[model samples]
Target: MVQSLARAGCEVTLVLKAPVRTGRLVDPLRGLPGVTVHSPHAAGRIPDHAVMVPRWAAGVLAELDEADPFDLVVVRGRQIAAKLAAGPLAGRLWTYLTDVPQHPAEFTGAAFGELRRIADASRMLLCQTEELRCFMESAVPATAGKSVLFPPVVALPEGLEPRAEGAPAGRALKLVYTGKFAPRWNTYEMTRLPARLTVDAEVHMIGDKVHVDPGDPGYAPRMQAALESAPGVVWHGGHPRAEAMRLTAACDVGLSWRHPSLDSSLELSTKLLECGLLNVPVVLNRTPMHERLFGADYPLFVATEDDVADALDRVAKDPELYALAAARCRAAAEDYTLDASSARLAGYLADAFPAADEKVLAAGGGRKLRVGIAGHDLKFFTRLLDYLNSRPDMEVRVDHWSALRVHDPAKGEELLDWADVILCEWCGPNALWYAERKRPGQRLLVRLHRFELYADWPRKLAIDNVDKVICVSPHYRDLTLAKTGWPSDKVVVIPNWVDDKQLDRPKLEGAEHHLGFIGLAPSRKRFDLALDVLEELRRDDPRFTLFVKSKLPWDYWWIWQKPEERAHFEEAFRRVRRSPLLSGGVVFDDYGRDVAAWLRRIGFVLSTSDDESFHLAPAEGMAAGAVPALLNWPGADTIYDTRWIHRSTTEMAQSIADTVRLGRWDADRRDGRAQVRAAYGLDEVCAQLVDALAGHAPADLGPAMMR
Candidate 1:
């Protein structure tokens, strides 16, 4: 977002929670005259800083109000950002939802409810494809006229030279696949391209380990040998996304392959759009998801392994068919561009918050005000609490009401009798009943996280009495409002904030062949794929060491409702756990505590999550100096474009091996901590929170509250 806005001539001032060292990524922006970047003091402990997640919320919002005011504000979540957008002094507030709330396989009644709420709250909503827009609109009637079907931006550097090979008319078929390749990619099959196809093809793969490690003991060698022995196959170790795109455009055939999984089954492929932008005809796997985006009549559809050759042959044989596919590709590319979507979205920003441009500061005008939250299970709420409490001027207080109900006649009255603001997270059954009985003027703030949206709680709660409703993501907000059938004006978007001070520190030098993953194993989390990547790494590079750490209690895995899914996950996790030794039973002699400590010895971190709201572990691991090997496309098409997301595990293993072979750790070693501190860190984010809050606080929010 910062990059696109900067390119569009906005005076881009990025106030990051941390500083990320993208090496040459910032070089172009550094040369830009209008771009200015700022870093604030991290909110928590100095070194190895903890994100003061709550305080940073209001702090950052307030800072933006004090700094140059923005004409339009687009917030990612319904958390703190929503509150700031609805607050006074804010301009056009556009709540943008990247993910449609519906989880294909994990939809408990609770998850479905959450999806509905987000759809209802959005005055203006953006969907990745027209099909997604239809889904969103059908799910929520409020979105019927207000939603816009726009694809995500295919962002490339403004003036980089186009790929060396333009549209291939008569060139040898050089096929290229880029991005993260995890177990979900079905890489064993991908690496067997020569065996799968009967045509003359040279395959080149550039992959990352964002989601899983393919170099583990069981799966690595076979995958590597498959590619190594394949005729005319060249594996380029993974490179940055921009570089990969440039190189991909040079090839004759572009591969945007995806193995259908819980997440992949519903996702719109970014690579397909990338290929389309470059006017490349894609031979895509035929799936309901792809059909939704490209329509059933689209020329590119591969039904089975047997169909692969014929599809390729047809494209090879007929120039007219090739030209037609290329033309369709170019036309399909138009919808995904940032320009087309931005134009349709600007109006929503104007309508949602008419007072955003008013320039009214907080109650005391630049002074911070402390706020308090009353909730339990602080794990999920901690970040918001920390950000709210971290500002130099803001103080935060939390009051836990064990098993307290928002609608309990006695509890609701007793809970907020003396509190400044009462925050109800996932309010229980009697929420509406209690909210109705509350005093007329009590400031009642209700928060709708993922749980409330997916569950039936929204239906039971009467949101009318609540003075404010807050959500974590715009998608969540839309989901909540749609499910709860609430007014759009009643909701707000506030994103969670993190502190990333460590991103600026110098990275370790000369260390190679280290991989790390810290997460609970699940299909949603993609632990199976992580193991595959590890297996692949071991086969491609012997010097490489796989580091695995799991803090999840073992009992979680033991208690599985679905035997098969649980068994699959457990077996994979076990393989990753046992992968520290070679076949002769030799231990690597070093495995550090936690992923961060392990990063000090390793060159890359495998962040393999199938679904995440905003993955903190991978970003944190990356900040700890582990080059992020991102699973390119995950649930809801979430991507962090941090030069880490790879396309395949083969690419990931090759990347690690190449780094070890060339003694070239420095070239790819990013100043991870700096990047985290600047953008993902807690302090800078808190300031933005303050600025956003001050800019959008309700007209009568009383004395300015600091984090």
Candidate 2:
């Protein structure tokens, strides 16, 4: 990676945790142009190696940065990145994660917390695979746009020719394995492959044994015995990386078959990439990632130890299959070559750090536009606020309201006085206050969600003083005009944005049978309808389950205080407990900010609301690669495709069942994801919001409204 950066014209500074006494350690990078290595001395006692190493490294980096400011600082490990993130140079860090949690269940505790801190501090997150990038974005919502793909770069032997021959004609078929002999790697099991093959074969192993599983203490001894005594096996342990690659190049096939438990990991195997670069056919598991690299029809894919032995026999017998596998490996490996990786790095750097342009400043009259956002809850506008604050052409401040209709009068008046444009987040009292007090020439914009349109706040808002009223949907925009008698030109539609990059993640195993519904409050959200669908689906397929992520009725005082709402929820709970099928089928998870992670278990997101201006849950579900089954609420067709919209619970359940039974669930999910990304992507919608906040009125509005 350092070589790739240096090759891309970057002045790379390589930092080592400990000084290297032997020249062999740094021999590969020697004489590389524009690359420098630094190993700083630790002066004091090192209490804990994990904590002290990072601390000493951070101090050395701080000193180096002070002496010569770096355009960017790259760190590989999560621990080191977290330590450096606490210092002053956090903004310049480009964190490259070599190790990360593989499953959603693993994303917790202190290590995961450090990952989040590192993500929040780093300028860019370099991921080793597309799946890892998606996991990082979903696990930590902050790393959405900054998280990028930087797959493993294959380093081939110098002047090595790509193999064009089939399996050796007269001799044994040589096989190679080039990583650790951890229990999960199935190295011990691989040692027995030579005995099982129909043709004579040689198995070459080239790495030290790593004991990782404490539960099975006998694994290490068994592995040692197999490596030493197994027939036709030659264990060449712990060679230098270059030498290992050369040894692997001479082999006819690579062994990468592993335990099935690791099949769901979000990391790509570097060993597989090396084999591909050498044009050697590898016997590997049939994982989604491996299938993508080597097509599903690749002849060497194996699921079990017995399958591995069978695949080897078939490869030895068929020369045509051997050649095809070799060609496919070489073709797939071309994208991960050193030159290709360097070009990708250079492109990312160019896009991340563009040359400063004065056009935006000039357009804004030689200064940034001072925009003030006033609201009690900015949950819907959080991404927009972050976007506006990140821009060089705009300055933003916020006057946070204490309640829906309450705020500090002094702070509100001060913001009104200072801001060139005041954006009222909701058409609540803040809008009424800003509309009446905003000075002439200062633009005032009010955004009305569904709740406010039904409230008295919209009627009380001074529409004459407001420059524009932003509605999340065209339906709400028209309703606002009709209800408040607001001018048609003043009301404009700007749909809610979905962070597609953050939400788009791979579905977990058996997600097709799982359905999700978020927010079942206010009685109008129609929790009863969701139960009807779940009940109907379970009647046909008992594997179907409903995962409800919501705040319980008692959690919201407004809903619990009403007798009708209390009765509605109590009856629903009774029905769930009384039905034998529904008792274990329905799960109610606590509502929280980790919606993306929760969505992985959900294949279908249910929007069974009676009425909604613009329900965001279905869009978010689509972004997460989950098909949405939405009720045909009023104006729902305007926001979503009709295929997702159903008229009744029975129809919705039937659609979901048909999708699963016909194996069309994944295809529908892919289509829905693409559609939602095109319509409600964060960057696109935020850009539109910024234009409106900057006093750039819609084309339909007259020029008189524009600043």
Candidate 3:
């Protein structure tokens, strides 16, 4: 979480317990840029309890006072949390509750009072799951609105893959149990799993005997004895977290079936997720929590020892089943990664702290660009804004002309005067408005994406005020030249930006058969062509499915406004609805945030748009190792090689089939990825924009102003 915050460009100071036993966790964080690890070293003995907590908190506060007021105080351990919550940092607190007490009903005296104080003081409570969140909220109704589901975080290990079920025939399926062996975990049941199983099994237990309390001396001994007596079990003494994960990765299933002490509905074991992170399937007791995290189809859930035996038998009988389960488990584990969970944490922190992201770094570009960007809908140009923000030399301000003042001249004039250069996205009345009020030296750059070409806005644009017209594609530039009658020299083609780094990912198995399309509903986008390609592919192989990453077509009234256009889409929709092959095979996934992960499930991405400025979705998919099957368009050749482009739907289908069968798919994927990296990288596009801006600038500003 610290690393994620630091990476997201936040200053982080990690406060740990005194006499820090620095190892794998602390050392790496200490080395990260913008990270400071502050552990208070004791001057003398200071016992941790209510007596010293106030004094200790004061000292901690004194240390924190040296810096500006902390945006958010992330209090981790339960012992020190109450003290921190009650202290000066009460309001900006986000209490992380990792280990909930098993006996919450017994909370009384100081414990109950402290718990209430912490819950009341905190801005938000972090729970591992919604189930746990509900449990905490029920226990303290004061926490109901504040708590957020903070899932278990395990960073994806590099070069780590789930154990493939390719072991030699009749090889024993290894079941590993590694975590706390306290009574609630049913450690004895886990140890007995191998003996109860009909299939050959080996249960390797690796964890420390958890000490619940100093008074309960008998608990650890009894648990350890039960583990030792169990047949077909090997008890390895506790290893460090990293080593345990490494050992667990070599096993087949992570074992965690136990007696449901307390409401099992609320319990979500982190170790099972740890196994999941390592791509090891889990043999867990079926619970509502488990079902929510892992879909109902998760085959390894066990109700009893006999059920455990049956699950083992079922997996052993078909190794492929184990492989598929492992794959699905690995897939499910992506959502719970440390980086993924930290985004949620960052959001809570942003709400609490508010100014962390806006905090400026000391060193920046010598002269800020003072770039004013005006747009009606900036949906297409968000990447451009991101690029401008990343550069220290650029300071950007945006005005939404459509949302604020649909036809107001005063607001547009104010925007034009604020900027040295004003770039209008979606060249319509917005461009015309900018062009009308531009000063002598001020530069105007208008970018025209595909949708605006058909609109009546092009002819109305004041070409004289516009110093440069940025087209997403060369074809759009030519079409705009004919429509607006702008001189050839005034227009330039800068491709749509693609962050190549995010797009590159490890492709999943059977992805080659998965066909993906980004937008499905639009008629001009030619979503039906994608279906046609999928149908053609399925004739040869049933595995083919067109995965349409889209918003619902009904949401956009523009596509249905024209009766003929609506009928065309309706016929296609009818075909998809009527045919079993088209209906089941056409997968509709709403446009998602994690495009890179979605790309991993697809082997080929289709750009079947009848008209396009630049088809970025296929390029993004290709960057993630998916082969591009592009439909021929005016500017298609300028972006991709002719080999990947097809003149017709049949040609596109044939191209996909040939690429798969003749082993050109991998090579084509590589070529498409390389093309995107070379042409549409943020740095590459930024340079082009800078150079163009420099060319249009007056001689007063030197070439240094270009970047």
Candidate 4:
């Protein structure tokens, strides 16, 4: 169970029972990825080959002091659970009951009394069958809602045996049974089954005489005598479990029969699932449980000798019927395989430890809040995550589109269910996904920056379900409200964060006239206007030069795909190459590491974009103590102070030259850096986000937008 669960990507920690009868499996269990094996002390001081039981209470109790908390704790019975209740993790307890005696005659103080106590204390009762669960609920009414059916599961064999080159062609239909023959099972009925068959049939009984009671020593001899009298019966004594499966594979059909009077109607036969998984059909006594699992039309449901004979004869008469029955059995077995069982178990455990809905942090003690971030581009948010990481109460999880933009719906659902609060970065597909799938008690926030306003994302996204729709600036907030009809109360304006710590580095000598522009390739960024600013500044002093810090325009797919845009940049770049005033004077520094150092080389930063919600380059440059020469973009006054905003490209160029000439640039530089630090420092921005996430309104939530 642990191995299969671990293989399915779950972290499994197994607390093994004593002496670990798991001799050969112990090493294999330890080697599986994400699987941890712990051994509890045995029941005795001395080694006893017989009756090895766990004296695990001491070891388990000691482990509780140091080990990390578990989402669930599953024990076998009352005494063990009672022992574990002494620890701090008592709340995460569950119990799996095995071989429960449901009959009133077996209800001694040792059985029913102990079971009732465990049922009352446990968080849930995991049982082997629905029949067993119903009986348990009636016997202990406190366990009524807790009981769940945990059916028997079989591992599908990995390797199949290759048949001999010329194996026998027209042989009898060979039947097999690979379990002990106790008298209660009515095993003597198998001796006459061969005679009742219409087709030539043989029965192979392979097992040790394990059913012989100490009081009835003659039982083994009697069974041997009955087997010898049976026609076409091959008796193979005692084989290992794996060998028995292999032996069953080399047969035509597996057989298991019992009278329904002995509580057999309520119980399941493990052999039925085993044979079904091997693609071998079985003939079992007609019962309601089997009918529900294998379907009512399954050809092998039988009761007496005549019914058993009829089921087999029908399969033998037509090859298609036999093939169809075998296929049906394999399909039925799919739900009972180990892989299927582990997945269901994982889901149960997930529900047992659901993500907390409320995210209030109590006084004194700290908590790790599950912060989920969903987005298309993670670059902006990822840079600011370090600030949140410094806090004692936050744990961040990032979700993005998978490779090739192929979304896994199930994986997305798991992340949604696991988070206390989800922050969607853009108002695109990712935001729409959370909007549609957000659960009832979960807090969901979507961030709308500039680009999403042009795309149809804002119109398609369901903002009514969102707790908050954050905009990077007040201008975008007003624009988004005007365009999308979002509730005005939910609209918030939190500025984009800039890492102030990464700035304030040492500047290079003679860099006062080295004007810098970042991200020049985009047509909307208006590099031509910035170059015009450079053209004006260069008329006085040839020392003035333009420094561009951006990705080469040709490398960007979005820019290169449009022929007009590409030619526009190509012509601009050619002019820079042709004129001596712009030729060797203009420096094209490709995008690289050390952004802080790159910003330090330039005395002034230019923002000549046609439009922007909250331009971050100026904020980053201001933090580096550079003067920002701006050609007023639409809403530029909202992002920066009006002193920095200019009316045209000529005005921006004059401001740059006048600042350097008057030597008043130092005061402007000092104030600009302080202004940026006050408005959009990384720490304050992260706190605003976490406050909203923890279900609180930060004092700094932006100016209210009226509908």
**lDDT of all predictions, in order shown?**
0.55, 0.83, 0.71, 0.72
Residue range 294-405, candidate 4, lDDT tens digits: 7778888777777878888888777777776777667877877888887767765544443333344431124677778877677678645534543446677777765314
The root-mean-square deviation over C-alpha atoms between each candidate and the true structure, in angstroms, is: 22.3, 5.2, 10.8, 26.8
Instruction: Please write out the lDDT profile of model 3 over residues 1-707, one tens digit for every residue.
Output: 68667765678888655565556677878888999887555333344322345457556765675567776676776767777776777766778876555456755667667766888887668777655665565565566546776766777455666555453255777888887776666676677777777777888889776656466678777667766776778788888877788788888888777775533546466677777778788777767566656767788887777787888778777778787667667777887777787676675554343221111221112355667888778877765675565455557788777552385566667777777778888777778777888888787888887667888777787887788888876667778888878887787777777767546655655788899988776687887778888888888878888887778677789866878778778888898899766768887775645565567789988888876777888777867889888888777776777777888989888878887889877887887777777777755676667555545323221111100
Clash count for each candidate, listed in order shown: 152, 0, 0, 0
Put down candidate 1 lDDT per residue, 358-404, tens digits, no spaces: 22224224444434465545655654564454334444555554654
TM-score-superior candidate, 2 or 4: 2
For model 3, give the 10-residue run with minimal summed lDDT.
698-707
Candidate 1: Cα lDDT at 650: 69
Cα deviation at 664, candidate 2, in Å, is 5.0
Question: Model 2: which ten-residue window has the lowest total lDDT?
Answer: 698-707
Ranking by lDDT: 2, 4, 3, 1
> Which scores greater on lDDT, model 3 or model 4?
4
* Number of the top lDDT candidate: 2
After TM-score superposition, what is the CA distance of residue 622 in candidate 1 from its true location, in Å? 51
Per-residue lDDT, model 2, residue 242, is 78
Off by over 4 Å in 4: 18-22, 40-69, 77-89, 104-110, 161-169, 213-218, 227-229, 263-265, 355-707
TM-scores of the candidates are 0.44, 0.82, 0.62, 0.49
* Worst-scoring 10-residue span by lDDT in model 1: 698-707
